[model samples]
Target: MRNVERFIGDKLQERKDNLSIRSLSTNIPPVDFCSNDYLGFARSGELKHMINSTLASMQNHLNGAGGSRLLSGNTRFTEETEAFIADFHQAESGLIFNSGYDANVGLLSSVPQRGDTIITDELIHASIIDGCRLSHATRFKFYHNNINDLESKLKLAKGNIFVVVESVYSMDGNIAPLLALSDLCERYKANLIVDEAHATGIFGANGRGLINQLNLTKQVFARIVTFGKALGVHGAIVLGSQNLRQYLINFARSFIYTTAAPIHNIVAVNCSYQYLSKIDHQLIHQKITLFRKALKENHIKTLSSESAIQGILFSSNEATKQAAANLQSKGFDVRAILSPTVALGKERLRICVHTYNTDEEIISLVNYLKELN
Candidate 1:
C-alpha cells in the first residue's frame, strides 16, 4: 500500500510539473459556454415541470430500479419507453444503458468477435477507445475524418469489419464525413456504428441525430444516443435491429451486471424527448451562426465546425488552461481541453453554443477571445 501511494503521488507530481494536473471544480461561471446542454434543455424549468407532472401521475414509482434490467429492474414501462425512443429515431429497436460511456462499452466490447477488425477514428472519444481495448478484436485507428485513410484500413481489416465513428466529435467540435464513410463501409461490407452523443438533440427534424437527418438510418448498423447531453437528462439508448437489442441484453456486461436507472430518470428521459419534438431547434443554429460570425469578425480562429460544439486550438496546455481561467474570471463557463485528453500541442478551449446564449453574450465572448488572441 505504501508503494502504491508513492506511485500515485509520483504520477500526480508529474502532472503538476507539466501544468496538466486535473481536479474537480465546482466553481462554475455564471454564463453558459462549456456544457453539452446545447439546446438549453438541461436548465429548462418547463422540462422539469413536465417531468414532475408526469411522475406525479404515476403510481408505485421506485426511487431505485431495485436491480439490473435483466432482473427485478425489468419493467413494462421501461421496455415501452425504449420502443418509443427507437420508433422516434426510426430504428427497428433499441436498448437503454446507464450512460453514453456504458452504451459505447457495452456495444463495442461485445459485438466484435475475436477474428473481427474494429476500425475507429483517430480522435474518437475515450469511451470508444476503452471499449475497443476491451474487445478481443484487432483494432485500428484511421486519420480523423479521412475517408481515403479509412478505406486503406478497411482493405487491411480481416474477418468481420466494424467501422466506428462519432457523428459529432466532442473535443474537436467537428462532424464526421458520415455520407462518405457510409458509402465506404457499404463498399467494404463493413458495419458502421455511429456514436451520436453530441448530435442527439441538436440535429435532425426533432433531434433524431445526424444519421436520421441525412437519411442514413437504414445504412447505419447501430447508433448510441445519450440523454445527458442536449436532452439535459440522463441515460443512453443503443439503436439497432431487434436482434442486436437482444444480443446486448444477453452479452453486454456493462448493461447486464449493473443496476438500472431510477424510475425518475427514465421518466425524465421520456419527458425530455417529448419536449424535444416541440421546441424550435432553429434557435440553437441561430446562436451557432452568431458565434461563428462573431469569431470571424474578431479574427479569432476556431476549428471548422457548424455544430453547437466549437473549439479554439492552443499550442500548449498552459496556454489553454490560462485562457479558460481568463474566461472564467469574466464569468463565462469556458473550459480547457488539455494534453492527454487530446494529443500534446493539440490542447484547446472547447466551447458549446446554446439556444440560451444571448446575441450580446456571443459577441462579448468572442471579443474576449480576440483580446486573448
Candidate 2:
C-alpha cells in the first residue's frame, strides 16, 4: 500500500523519457491548420444565432438534461433530432450517444455477442480499439485499408463477423474504400460498420457522409457520425436499422447510464446540422483541392489523401515534435502524432485544413515545411 503511488509516477516518467508526455493547451493560434473544424462551423456566429433563437422558442427550457435518456432525460426534441439525422443520412433510424467514444464503445461492446468475431483495420481509431477490447467477442486487426489482407482474415473468421473501418481516417486523412469494403463484407457475410466522424459535413449530397456519397447506404450495416468534428458541435449518433437503435437503447451501457446531453447542446447540434444541410460542399472541396495542390507544388511528401486530414511523416518522435514546434512558432497550430499513438517509426505532424483557411495560409504552411527541411 505504501508503494502504490510509485507505479503511477513510473508510467508518467516513461512518457516523459520517450518524448510522448501530453499536455493541454487552450490557446488557439492565428493560422488554423490543426483543428477538426473542417467546415469552419465550430466558429460560426450563424450557428450560434440559430441555436439561441431555437432555444428561445422552447417552453421552460432547462439548463441540464437532469437524467439519462432511459430516465427523465429524453425529450421531444431528442426524438425529433434523431429522426432528422436518420432521414438526412439515408438510414432507417438514428440513436444519439454522448460522444463518438461513447457511441463506439456502446455499440462494439454490446452488439458483438459471445462467440462472435470482430475484424477491424490496424489503423482504426483508439476509441474503437478500446470498445473491441471490452467486448466479449474475439477481435482481430487487418493491415490498414488493404482489401486483400481484410479478405484473408475474413476467410478464416468464425461465428457472426463484423468488419469496421473509418470513412475518413483521422490521422492520415485518407478515405476508406467503402464501396470495395462493403463488397467484401457482402462476399463474406460480414456486417460492415463505418465511422464517418470526419466525413459527415464535407461529403455526400448535402454532406450525408461517404456511405451515402457513394450510394452504398444499403450496403453498410451501421455508421457512427460525430458532431464534434466537422459539425462544429458535441455528441454523436449511430445510424443503422430501427432494430439496431432498439438494441443499443436496451443493451449499450454507455448510452443507458450516462446523463443525456443538455437541451441547449442538443439544440446546438440540430442547428449545426440544419446549417450543414444547406452549406456548399463544392466550396469546401475547393479548399481541400487548393491545399493539396500547394503541398504538391512544394514537393512535400505527405500521405495520399483527398480529405482535410493530412499528415507529414517524420522518422522519429523527436524529429516530429521539433517540426510541430517549428510550425507552431510561425503561428500554425499543427500537432505531432508521436509513437505509441502511432507506430515507432511512423511519427508524423497532423495538419487539418478548414474552409476558413485562406490560400495564403495554405501556401505558407507548406512552404514553411519545405523551408524547414
Candidate 3:
C-alpha cells in the first residue's frame, strides 16, 4: 500500500508551509504572566480541599466518562451542577459541556439553523468562530467592540439572527459595549450570545460573570462560561432557556458524542462557585484596583478595563516578546499575545490580575516595564 507514514508527514509539512505550526514545550522557572488562572484558584489549597472532599464522596474515576452524556454518562452531579449554574446565572436552565471550546462549538453549531444569520464581534474567541463555521448560518463579523458597526450589520440582516460577542475581549483585555449591543439586538430581533471565558470569579457580584452582574442574562439568548480559567477547573456550561438547553441536549454533536466531563472536575467547578459566593469580593477587586494603579503609575498605556485582565500593548511582536522576556528575567510572569491571535498592529502582553497577585508584584512588574523604556 501507499505508505501511511507519508500521509501524516505531508500534513505536518502543511503546518510549517503555512507558518501555523504550533509546538508544545515546558516553561523555564519564571514568574507568572501567561496563565488564565485569574483567581489563582488553580493552585489554591481551598479548591484542592473542595476537590478532595468531592473525591471522598465519589469514586476516583479519573477515567473517561466512558460515553456521551445521553448514553450512560449522565449523572446527578451533572444535573445538579447545571442546575446550580443556571440559578447562579439566573437562567432557566444550563447545559454542561466538557470545555468552553466544546460548549461554544455545540451551541453555535447546533442551535443556529441554515437560514439564520450570525453577526459576531470580530474579537470573539476561536471556539465561537469554529462553532459558527460548523453552523449552517450566514455569518458576518462586526468591528471589535464597535456597537455602531454591529447595529449597521444588524440592521441589514433579514432573517433569524444571532449576535455573538465576548463580555471581555481576551487579547485586548477590554470590555464590550454590552448595553448598546443588547439594545441593538433587541431592535433587530436578534438573539445575543455572550462568552464570559475571562470574567468568571474575577468580576460580577458573586462571580456569576459580567453579564449576570449586569442583570442582562434575561436579555441574552445563551452564555458560555468556563470553569477552567477563573473557576480553577475544567468544563463549561451553556446557560439559557429550558427549551434552548433541551435543544442542545438533543442535537449538539459535541455534547452528544463526546464523553461527559469527569465527576471531580464538575465538583471542582461547584466548589469554585461556593467559594466565590462566600469570599470577600473586595479583596479581589482591590487587586484589580492596585493593578490598574501600577499600570498608570508606570505610564504603560493600558486599556480602560475594569476586569482582572489588563494589557500592555507594544509596537511589535519582537517588542512584545522582549517585554515578556524582560519580565521573566526579573521575577514577574507576563505574556505577549502575538499577531493572528490578535490582529496585526495590536499585539499585546496580556496581564491577568488575580486574588493572589499582590500589590507589590503589580507595582514591581509595572516599574520594571518603565525601566525597560
By TM-score, the better pick of 1 and 2 is: 1
Ranking by lDDT: 1, 2, 3
Scored by lDDT, model 3 comes in at 0.82
The TM-score-based order of candidates, best leading, equals 1, 2, 3
TM-score of 1: 0.99
Model 1 weakest 10-residue run by lDDT: 71-80
Residue-wise C-alpha lDDT for candidate 2, range 83-149, written one tens digit per residue = 9999999899999998999999999999998899999999999889989999989889999999999
CA lDDT scores, all candidates in order = 0.94, 0.92, 0.82
Top lDDT model: 1
For each candidate, what TM-score against the reference?
Answer: 0.99, 0.98, 0.92
Q: For candidate 1, give the lDDT.
A: 0.94
- CA displacement after TM-score superposition, residue 14 of candidate 2 (Å): 1.1
Residue clash pairs of candidate 3: 31-333, 32-333, 33-333, 33-334
- Candidate 3 residue-wise lDDT, 102-164, digit = tens: 999999999888888999988889999999999999999998888888888887775789999
